[model samples]
Target: MGVPVASGASPLDAHELLRKGEVSRALVLFEKMHDPRRPDPAVLAGLVESRLALGEAHRVAPLMPHLADAALHAPSKDHHTGLAHWALAGLAELEGDHDRAAGHFRSAGEAGPDDPDLLPWRAGLALALTRQGRSPEAVRLAHEHLTRARASGSAYARALALRTLAAVDGASSRRDLLTQALEELEGIQATRLRAQVLTDLAGVLVLLHEDRGPGVIRLLREAELIAVRSRLRPLLDRVRRLLTRLDQPAGSTAPPGLEGLTPSELRVVELAASGLTNREIAGRLVVTVKAVEWHLSNVYRKLGISGRKELPT
Candidate 1:
């Protein structure tokens, strides 16, 4: 039998773990390679990406400039430079700087031309374009990449292309595209990507039905569970916001007596106002009793009431 890898794996091993969504283990391995004297570009890039994926964007901000300089001035034109740029782009995207992200993705493509048959740069560009409101260009680029990915039989590429398409498509087509994307991700070990797909799928489901039907709530709950279990803070925050949004009725403003409360607080107030006890309201809102109590306390304080007995009666 071949020799087994040591407990402390190499940078390649760490990168492979990161790619497979074993981020915590990968971070432990990559941290061992941190050498300021002569930094390994591969290890640096992988560590940065692993940190980003784990929602530690702020933690890695100080090293981004150095990483960018190294990527831009690298000796070889290969995966290291491309990955460095991709990591930078991801950070920019997380910070809500689409322009910077687009520039970095372009630089990545320049550093190492994307494999059109597999993971195409055009696909990433299309997603950025979609966010920038260049839907027509995004659609065209997505079709090109999707066609090539399908022909090449790359499930990961096809899923990515489909998700890009779904983001730019109209509501009707968007639903179908997201559905197909989830199907592609379902068979893979990319748990983070799967959670993202589930979030997008939940968004589409909500759009398709304004009532926050059972199906939509179910999808969102699944996504939320994954985000929480993986400790993906960004996605967890997103899922919570989506849940809060769905809880409110369309064009719903606070009731006349409860005008000052926020949408979420107003929701709890309305549920309670409808004669639902604390336990019932908690169940209806899918929240804990403490959360329900907190909102009720805020509501009582704002309304200048001693108890629920004085609420709108």
Candidate 2:
């Protein structure tokens, strides 16, 4: 509905649709173009990715061997080959094969180190390293890629780099990196990636334990809402699991910047911290947007913060 791309759509159209979270539409396009005996590696990879994102693990499992075979026959320098490897890496990660995933990600990276299109490979490798308990190396790799991502000025790249850094920096720092990642993701209209980042941010908040209980709970709640709205089952389940952990009783401690605020003001502050715009917050609360803005203004004044970005997470 957003774009008339389905008519005579190409793989690029499918890719764009996938980026926009129209997984079913993208799948239709890919299925129309796919050949059983000689599948295009790029389209096959995209199909695999869409299925995985939709929580169709059974479907993706059956497709894996074919996708791998296609990747095997693909040329070394072919970008489609790299994409196939990237899809394989994702599948490996899903199966908890960190070593294999890292290897595949490395292959993806080698296929096009400076192609300006393999940021996902770099980010995936960094995540794989973190999962393998190589956080220091992950941090270093992610830092280098963060520099490149910043230079690219692409929000997606920056969000990935920020998420990677947040994953690697779990124990060493507070929730700043993950918070920045949330801010970056919130600015984008990509629901799928935003849900993923929200899930990651919830996990990071649980690990950090630096934020107040109320605020952390609020952030996780927002993430759960988004995950459910986006139908991202994996992230939705994760947010639910993390919320259980947060619900367990812990020592009560209110984080700074929230002192002396009424419950209404506090709620506004929490929503803002979780990266919702005033209009969104109003819609969520069934209140007027002007009322939401007024509440946020009071919250900022009380917290001595100037903007939504300055809200404490």
Best by TM-score: 2
How many clashes (backbone atoms < 3 Å, residues ≥3 apart in a chain or on different chains) does model 2 have?
A: 0
* Tens-digit per-residue lDDT, 1-313, candidate 1: 0111246667878776665566655665665576766666677777787777667776787667767777768854676677777777777877888888888778777877466532266777778878898888878878887887787776777787787777766543877787898788777777666777778888866766743777777777776766644445677777777788778322223334556777677666645554567886687568999999999899899989987766662
- Give lDDT for model 1: 0.70
Poorly placed runs, candidate 2 (over 4 Å)? 1-5, 113-119, 170-174, 212-214, 248-313
Q: Which lDDT values do the candidates have, in the order given?
A: 0.70, 0.70
Q: Estimate the TM-score of every prediction.
A: 0.70, 0.71
Question: Model 1 segments beyond 4 Å from truth?
Answer: 1-8, 116-120, 248-313
**What is residue 207's positional error in candidate 2, in angstroms?**
2.8
Candidate 2 lDDT tens digits, 1-313: 1122345778777877777666655665776677878888778888888777756677777678877897788788777888888889999999999999999998888766444324367788888998999988887888878888888877767777777777676564436776676677666666666666766766765675666377777776666665543344566667777877766432112334354777577656655554456886686467999999899888778778787777664
Model 1 TM-score? 0.70
